[model samples]
Target: MENTMVFEEPMTAEKCSGHLSSVEDAIYVIGGKWKLKIIIALHENGNIRFNELQRIVAGISARVLSNELKDLELNGFVKRVVHAEQMPVVVEYISTDYSRTLKPVIMALSEWGRKHKKNIREDLF
Candidate 1:
């Protein structure tokens, strides 16, 4: 069994509409200035505290980070864990299984961005 998304051939208006809707839904969940960045940071760093995540994401204000985290959690891409067992309670954010589904998409986007940057630099020079 292959673990991948496969679209059937034969282009039709209905199929295109369905595809567009799927894309839009994905964007709705992850489309924001800081969502993907926050996801990438959590993905790379494992569980992290709010302040640490803010530092890792860089340039995102505390309020924005908090809001983004809440959004991500609401969308099922992130998990918030509150640790009240220890002397000092701690809160951490971790990427959920659903967030892992975006890995390929993110990598493809990153590749495209790199190529786009190279093209821009070449054009400028």
Candidate 2:
């Protein structure tokens, strides 16, 4: 079974009516189809340029990647470094200290994905 780590508790009337916790906001920022993927990609590569990141994480469109990068930067999980070059400078996305907190979450997701894929392949075969 895939044990994906969720950032929010069970949504109930009480939880919904009340303010979300910091953990909840953290989850909200990093909890998405592509948000975590971006984090992991930056982590593995240390620092990567915008276009390079778009290429590494397949299937994410340019607009979505750009928007997510902005969100991550806004949430302080990513640091955007702008290089001072000639025409058409470069911007690199680097993982911030806040992102390190999701290390265990990433580990769990990786293990779950590996197990789930193996199970699927086994069933198919």
* The candidate that achieves the highest TM-score relative to the unseen native structure: 1
Best by lDDT: 1
Q: What digit string (tens of lDDT, one per residue) describes model 1 on residues 1-125?
A: 25666667776899889989999998998998999999999999999999999999989999999998999999899999999997689998999999999999999999979988998999999
Which regions of candidate 1 are displaced past 4 Å?
1-8
lDDT of 1: 0.93
Per-candidate Cα lDDT values, in order, are 0.93, 0.88
The estimated TM-scores of all candidates read 0.88, 0.71
Q: Which pairs of residues have clashing backbones in candidate 2?
A: none
**Distance from true position, residue 4, model 2, in Å?**
16
